[model samples]
Target chain A: MVNRLIEPTSGRILIDGRDISKDDPIALRRRIGYVIQQTGLFPHQRIGENVAVVTRLLGWSRKRQRERTDELLTLVGLDPARYRDRYPSQLSGGERQRVGVARALAADPPVMLMDEPFGAVDPIVRERLQNEFLRLQEQLAKTILFVTHDIDEAIKMGDLVAVMQQGGELAQFGPPDEILARPATDFVARFVGADRGLKRLSLSRVGDLELQTAVTAHPGDDAEEARRRTLADPFRYLLLTDDDHRPIGWVDQDDIPRSGVLTEALAIPMSPLVSRRTTLKDALSMMLAADVVAGIVVDRTGRVLGLVTVESIAAAMRPPDRGVGAATDGSGPDAARRLAAELAARDDQELGRTEATRA
Target chain B: MEAFIGVFAWFADPANWQGPNGIPTRLLEHVVMSGVAIGIALLVAFPVGLYIGHTGRGAFLAVSLANIGRAVPSYAVLVIVFPLSIAVNRETGLFDIAFVGTLLAMILLAIPPIVTNTFAGMRGVDPDLVEAGRGMGMRGGQILSRIELPVALPVILAGMRTAAVQVVATATLGAVIGGGGLGRYIVQGIARFDYQRLVAGALMVALLAIATELFFSWLQRRAVSPGLSGRSVRAYENVAQLGRVDVPAV
Candidate 1:
């Protein structure tokens, strides 16, 4: 309806405060980016010409169209020189979706309509495309109306999600975290699912948390001093780094020799490194998979910044109080409180178990 | 065996090649008549097939026309058109009666395959492709020309080939109405009870039919997209292998 592909029978749709019903559909659609689930790429045309469809229709010169095609393909992370001349049939499903995205953005329209654009690919590819799309949206900031039946995807992708019921009625509309935390109706709650709290973790990135400093020592450092540092720390472990400050591994206080030099051989493999851009959910998954309670956060240069513990991650997921750590910043105190309540409940169960044993 | 040798002897005679009623003249006449009839049929049926296919309307009309064309034999059509052509020529003071009657019969024989194949070909185009073209802001004419026509070209060419071969074979019947074609030799030889002329004429018509089939098949291969016509090339190879088996007998 926004692109006027289908006209509304009763209500009028306004874009930029102008009623679109009265506008010429072709002229209006020219200014809007439209992408469908199947990618809808023309198999007969090369990727370059497929991406340049709208530009050609708008009377762009051949030189300008070629340049724009390359630019759009490059923007979607496809190498223009390699992909430009290839037919759509020669591309993989993920590559086709990338071309589809590039084609929709060819005209650089202010608004984009994506209907499950990444839905056709496998799960791994879908996740990659979603991350790439999110990164692209961060730069483009185009007003996009994304439609998907997957609730998790809705929470992850939409800055503001509109939950619609059967008969095309709007059930709720708000930010993803807000919609997840407080569904407007029973249907909305059921739709968001019971694990809404866990789903909300995906929206927050590790960059949003205040990471705690981990005690560190250089690989060439004196073993006595490193041991003292490791023993002093509550975790009793010291992270070893190279000259560039990139983390090599961790050394337990027990593993530190009493009178020798700290060497690379002494350090054991560390948990997976989490970048600032890594989502909190993914970061936690990495930590769990590595059987470690904390992950080292690194910068783009791979230099260690600080450590993110499960406590801080859980703290960030807490419910909002005084608008601090709300969905806007992906931090809240409610998650910490919820964690405390669960711990207390566990303790009660443990106490009851002991009493039953005595009886 | 003796009759076949006599036919070969008739073709070898230089005098038979130089006269007004020579092999070249008869072959040229046959080709022109078939070409003109096919051209007329294309002009008449192509638009109707295209329109019906693109709009998805008048499908019943296309099917009915095809069935009717098949039911009416070319001989019956020629007999029916003879008196109609005479009356129309008298009223309009135009059109030679014999030529009009013969052309009408060949045209009726050619329309069914052309119209049926063209309609089926256009209708078989992927709807998603058409929708994609429209979604990209293509006008109706652009979609038809740029996307639909190219994708449907192979099937349409197949239909044209069918019509061409059928018209080439059927044009021989024009000799019955005094139309100038290679069929004239056969009709004259039969009337005179001359076995050599009859065999020679029959051999020439058969060769012409085979040559027309091969030419259209080559044309079809060139016209179709490589992606769509992969199996066709292999199918042609199989037919060629069969042709090799028949070459020894010749």
Candidate 2:
């Protein structure tokens, strides 16, 4: 309806306060980008031609079209030199989807309608494409209407989600955080699922948490000193680091010899190493999968910064009380209160999980 | 075996190469008749076939027309049109009775495959492609010319190949209706009891049919989109396979 592919029987669609029904549909469609689930690429055309479709229709010169095609292909993370001359049949499903997105963005339409754009790919590729598309959208900022049946995708991609119930009636409309935190109706709540708090974790990043400093020791450090330091700390494990301050592993106080130097062979394997950009949900999942109490947070250069424990993550998810500063306290009345709330929240999450499994 | 040897010996004789009734002239006549009949049948069938295929309307008409074209014997058509051509000639002095009758027969033989294949080809184009074209804001004509035609070209050409080969073989029937072609050699040889000429004429017809098949096969390959047919190596294999099934019923 937005692209004027099918005319609505009763209502008029307005774009920029102008009724699109009054505009020439071809001109309107050229000005608005459209993408569907199947990627809809013309098999007979080369990738270059597919990307430049709208540009050519708009009468761009051959040189301009070629330049734009190359630029768009590169923007979609496809190497223009390698992929431009290839046909759609030569590409993988994900590659074809990238080309589809490139084609839609060719004319740089002010509005884009994406209907399950990443739906055709596998989960890994879908996540990668979703991230790439988000990164591109950060730079472009085109007014986008993204449609997907997956609630996770809708929450992840949409700034303001418009949830529709059966029969295409709008159930609720608001920012993803609001929609997840305070669903407008019971249907909306059920649709978002009972694990809304867990889902919200995906929205927050590991960088947002106040990480605690892990007690560190080099491989050649005195084992007796490391053991003393480990016993003094609440977490009785000494993090062994290389010369560059990157984590190698952990050494338990019980395993430390009385007066010998620490060695790489003595340390147990470290927990999951997550970069600051990792989402809280992913970080927690990795920590759980590794059966560790905390994840080592690393910088871009892979140098260890600090550690993020599940307690700290749970503390972060609680309602902000005093300030960001007090939330970092490992043991206080506020921390105790937050821990109680976290326990209650975990119970609620467990209930939600069982309900989800039943459904 | 003796007739086959006699066929080669007839080709070796230089005397048979020289006049309007010679091997070369008769072969030319045969090619022209086939070409004319195919051209006329294409003009009559292509538009109707494309219309039916594109609109998806009159599907029954396409099927019924194809069935009717196939069911009517070419020999019967020749005899039927012979009287009509003679009547037209008597009324207007414009049409040649024998030529028109024979041409009509060959055209009737060619139409079924051309029409059926064109309709089937267009119908076979993925509807998703057509929908994509429409979503891209292509007008009806643009979608047909740019998207539908290119994708369906292979199947359509295969159909034309079938029709062309069939026409070439069927045009030999012109000899039965007082028309001139390589079929003259067969008719005369049979009348005079010359087995050598009969074998030579049959062999030439076979060679002509083979040449027609190869030419159209090449044309089909050239016309199809490379994306659909793949690269040259795979496409050559496809053409070889296409040859086995595309042979005319003759």
Clash count, predicted structure 2: 0
User: Best TM-score goes to which candidate?
Assistant: 2
How well is each residue in A1-359 modelled by candidate 1, as lDDT tens digits?
A: 78776778898888999998888887787788878888988755668878998898889999999999999999999999778866677789999999999998989999888888888999999999998999999999999989887778888888899887755667789999889877887557656765787788888899999988988988778999878887888876889999999999998889999887889998898978999989898999998999999999999999999999988998887765536534542336766675565566665545443332222
Model 2 agreement with the true structure over A1-359: per-residue lDDT tens digits: 88888788888898999999999998888888878778989877778888887888889999999999999999999999878866788889999999999999999999998978898999999999999999999999999988887789999999999887755567789988778876887567767876887998898899999988999999888988888988999987889999999999998888988998999998898899998899999999999999999999999988999999999998877755446675354687877886676666766655543343223
TM-score of each: 0.80, 0.81
Candidate 1 lDDT score at position B159 = 83
Report DockQ per prediction, comma-separated: 0.23, 0.39
* Deviation from native of the Cα of residue A122 in model 1, angstroms: 3.2
> In CAPRI terms, where does candidate 2 land?
acceptable
Give Cα distance to truth, residue B150, candidate 2, Å.
0.6
**Candidate 2 wrong stretches, greater than 4 Å:** A210-273, A290-298, A301-312, A315-359, B231-250
Report lDDT per candidate.
0.82, 0.84
Candidate topping lDDT: 2
Clashing pairs in 1: A318-A334, A318-A335, A319-A334, A319-A335, A325-A331
CA-based DockQ, model 1 = 0.23
